[model samples]
Target: MLSTKSFKGVNVFMSRNLVPPEVFDALLDALKLNGADVFLCCDPSRHGHNDFHIISSPDHEKFEDLKAKGCNLLGPHCVLSCAKEHRSLPKQGFTCCLAMDGIKVLASGFDMDEKVKIEQMVTAMGGVLQTKASVDVRFVIVKNVSAAKYKWALNVLKKPIVTINWLYQCWNEHRVVPQESYRVLPFSGLTICVTRIPADKRKEIEKIIIQNGGKYSAELTKKCDKYKVARRWGHIHIVTRKWFDHMS
Candidate 1:
């Protein structure tokens, strides 16, 4: 399907790699769902030890049938090169770099010395570098997906913040270690009033509190400074000092 056909300013370039049978199934599904077309690059080296076969009937099931055809999988090198070149078109848009198992690796990692080559190719094509997370297939949207990237980064870089909020709401949700990471910092000499559960639970909670420059209470008495409640984790809430202070 490498015919020189284009759609919506986006070009599909299938690599010479022997795509796993299941992968082709997913690809067909994605194409139909996203209304995308296909492009194929012919490379003998990528065909493994088996000869290349021309698949005219590109359907989900047909793609799956090719799985046991016994050909080895091809590397993504051809596709990566095409994507780099595609980035040069002034209106080519974004080219998403995808990988398997929702694990994304930067195309730049393939050949670090060619960094300028890829960047220049993208700049000329009016696109950017982005990775996609997909269990079956990953790819970049080739446009400004910075918002998506930021969302991913937040979850990865601020996992502790997320864990803290999650554990605070329901200390019993996960193992005690999670709760132990959260501490209630006392302010204005107010003893934090907390529900005293068990010795182990109290110890874990107290450790988190002390680490964060806070104190813990053994019982929910009126003399307690503030109430530390692990509430439903709202990611944004976890990032705030107010949440930390309140929890502490």
Candidate 2:
């Protein structure tokens, strides 16, 4: 049973761009029904000191401003999870990992108890846990990389396989750490460099590369295995912007 007093005395400010209109309405109604003092806008003067500001992404324009005002920034899933769990969850690090919402996941090498726990956490965070590896399953959480299911997910289905630790890390930190860092050396022994990319995109790519067991060079270097620019280097593989899209 869902608890109506989950958000009892909490003040929540939902961004208008947090979700689609219908989805936003549903979330707003849910927050109110769960006993939160919901606000449609970020009017700090009207809210208390412990107010939470729910935004679409941490990159939202108001993120720094909200942080400066000491407001808790969280994703929409935090509200849903808190409501379902019947308590106001800790808002720390919630905004850092926004990809969990609506993500389709499959568990590959876990016992019954572990799988159940994984399902509970995933669903609580607005993620979908699948019983089988389907085309739509975006990620496969595995206990053993050598397991048949893991191989099928990686080699056959071409799905990104991550260890159970990835899930636990995200839960513990309240933020989804890079899954590539928990994978089995997916890009081991590779050095990559990015150029002519937007600052935001470059940061994302660099993080992914470093997490996947690769080194990132801000400038073109002779040791770079992959260079995302029009540089004619015989040893380096020059790629276009589309490479980022394909790799991601």
Top candidate, metric lDDT: 2
Clashes of each: 29, 0
TM-score of 1: 0.22
The number of the candidate with the highest TM-score is: 2
lDDT of each: 0.33, 0.68
Per-residue error for 241 in candidate 2, Å, reads 39
lDDT of 2 by residue, 33-140 (tens): 888888787664533445777776555776666767666666666666666656664555334333376689999767899999898667645577999768888888
Deviation in Å, model 1, residue 77 alpha carbon: 19
**Residues 73-93, candidate 1, lDDT per residue (tens digit)?**
222232333333332112212
Cα lDDT over the full model 2:
0.68
